[model samples]
Target: MVKIGIADTTFARFDMGKAAIDELKRNCSAQIVRYTVPGIKDLPVACKKLFDEQHCDIVMALGMPGSKPVDKTCAHEASMGIIICQLMTGRHIIEVFVHEDEAPDARELAALMEKRAREHALNVVKLMFKPKILEKEAGTGQRQGYEDVGPARI
Candidate 1:
């Protein structure tokens, strides 16, 4: 049996962790270990605990960085921590982040977070158990609903 760990922050309006869990449950049976923290900065430790204590197979670390410049900096730092944790543990940690300032309005932000969470949940399932489901788009560079912002080669 696969154990999925979910680390979520309480700073967001939408319930991204729940959305991810719901999406995951639709595909197959698995035990979901959930840990909620106060903000993005707390995500790394929470995820570490979930892996070391709960024995999760894969982890989804979800956060919503605010609109301030300092918030982005915090997000970057938190991301680095997560990367370090993944390297140390030799496990996959899906970073599910939706910056609060990405959308212009509240409704759009909520919708995007929900959709993104669910999509990433499926990705978690694929990465852990069914790799074939994800292989169909191996090199398509298709990010679902997100617009492509490929690098420039000028």
Candidate 2:
């Protein structure tokens, strides 16, 4: 079995991070691991473990992109571009949904991400889960979405 590891950081201001994991659990094939570290040293260990212990062929990471939101058109296009760039890595990198209210959940994201992954002949070693905008935060400036690593690594 191809092992995939998911790492996430708790977002104190919103629920999107947790929701992203829930969506990922519902959709993707990779094993999910939550990381609550305050520093980078504690976080990257999972990546090493995925690379060393489980030997996961890929490692996808999920986290909120803490920036003021842009308009819909730019946000959507930019998010898609990021997804495509990640796909070029030949690994899956389900990114946090920039437009949470409008974006699809993990299942849908995985399907889309996988299709893109295959286009570049990259085996999916990891799947990242990004949440749509939290229900309460709808219409706020926050954007949400998912992304995966891509074939550029291959």
Candidate 3:
């Protein structure tokens, strides 16, 4: 059985991890492992632990960055760390970051988080079980939380 890992932050106002897990459960038969930390900066290590200790085949690093410059900086740094962790482990980490500024209100922000997390969860399923589906979606300009921009007209 496939094992999917989820690393999330309490700094987030919403529970994006739950959304991802729900989606995963609806679509696949994978063993889901979750690790929660206090802030976005801690997601990388949490993901690493899930991979190393729990032996997850893939991971989703979910975070919600506040609408501030400092928060943006921290989010970027966390993203880089996640990349490095992926490189070190030779596995895929789907970084799902929803900035608080992306939406005008808390309700919208929460909705966005759920949409993005669920969509990425589907991507995880495709990656693990049906990668050919992803190949078919290449260059389609897919968007998770909002309307897709569609492929560019050259």
Q: Each candidate: what lDDT? A: 0.89, 0.41, 0.96
Write model 1 residue lDDT over 89-110, tens digit each, in one string. Answer: 9999999999998889999999
TM-scores for all predictions: 0.92, 0.36, 0.98
> If the candidates were sorted by their lDDT against the true structure, best first, what order would they fall in?
3, 1, 2
- Residue-wise C-alpha lDDT for candidate 2, range 1-154, written one tens digit per residue: 5455554445323433345445545555556454443322233554555455655555544433333364345445535654554455454444333323332465554443343323211212222232232343344443122243332432
Clashes of each: 0, 33, 0
Candidate number of the best lDDT = 3
lDDT of 3 at 148: 86
Please tell me which model should have the higher TM-score, number 1 or number 3.
3
Candidate 1 or 2, higher TM-score?
A: 1
Residue 44 shift from truth in candidate 1, angstroms: 0.7
**Superior candidate under lDDT, 2 versus 3:** 3
Taking the tens digit of each residue's C-alpha lDDT, what string does model 3 give over 1-154? 9999999989899999999999999999999999999999999999999999999999999999889999999999999999999999999999999999999999999999999999999999999999999999999999988898889987
The weakest ten consecutive residues by lDDT in model 3 span 145-154
What are the clashing pairs of model 3?
none
